[model samples]
Target: MNEIELTIEQSKIYNGVICPYCKGISEMIKSKEIYGKDYGWLYICKPCDAYVGCHKNSKRPLGRLANKNLRKLKNEAHRYFDKIWKLKILDRTKAYNWLSEQLNIPFDYTHIGMFSEKTCRTVVEISKRALNDNRRLDMDFGVEPVTEFFETI
Candidate 1:
């Protein structure tokens, strides 16, 4: 019907993946194209300017290309999720495993980097709830809260 729909149909027929916003095939290019400094390569949808960084030392994309809004959501999700392990309530692997269980996805596929915007929002919500629950439990059980203890140099 629309130009975007037509492109999406064509993209599906091809081997390459389509951009979520513009329905265009993404291109792999150096990050310098966008950032003016070579951070690394990225899979990018040029028209939409949506992009995902590659894995270290490889061209493989870290996740689906994300626009500004999705990127913001992903950052928010990470901020909340990181606290679970940062507080030492759980180790990194265990924290991801816990998130996997909560999200009802396979542990191997449960990375926040690969999450959709809706899933990212879910992560933020769930992590906040878990943090609150942990605080309540700590209060009830008289457990001391763990926080950074700084000593004067």
Candidate 2:
């Protein structure tokens, strides 16, 4: 590509980012602008009123910029889904793989950050059901995890 074309492409992905909600260009700024204290960096779209955080020490977005409701859904999804691994029903990686299989999505696209609101709700439902069932688990105190039976949920 020519220099001008390359520059345009770079602008599209650089510190001035894109708002997934509005498709408008977002600007990278310190987290203090939104949070009242410097937590890290974020890409904010003022007109659309959306933002997303960057990876630690990097400008790459953790996920798409979304509205408030979607952010709340993501948090709720994490609350339910985290128990599968946090309770040692499966290790973190295997828990993710189980969720991927349940959703019929590749592992790469199965993150809560990447999920639609519907998908987040599904994760919450599935995770809650899986944990509550405990069909594969023995009566032990969350010590003996039967990873194979996560499929039953």
Highest-lDDT candidate: 1
> lDDT score of model 1?
0.75
Task: Give the range of the ten consecutive residues with the poorest summed lDDT in model 1.
Answer: 1-10
What's model 1's TM-score?
0.76
Please report how far candidate 1 places residue 142 from its true position, in Å: 4.2
lDDT by residue (1-153, candidate 2, tens digit) is 112232553345433466666667788889999999887898888888777777888877777676788789989889878988987878999999999989987777667876778898899889878886664445356556444344323
Q: Over the stretch 76-145, how does candidate 1's per-residue lDDT look in tens digits?
A: 9998889999988789999998998899877766777677899999998888877777776776789875
Worst 10 residues of 2 by lDDT: 1-10
Q: How high is each candidate's TM-score?
A: 0.76, 0.76
Number of the predicted model whose TM-score against the real structure is largest: 1
The models' CA-based lDDT, in order, is 0.75, 0.74
CA RMSD per model (angstroms): 8.3, 7.1
Model 2 ranges with Cα > 4 A deviation = 1-16, 135-153
- Candidate 1 positional error at 99, Å: 1.0
| Cα error, candidate 2, residue 2 (Å) | 34
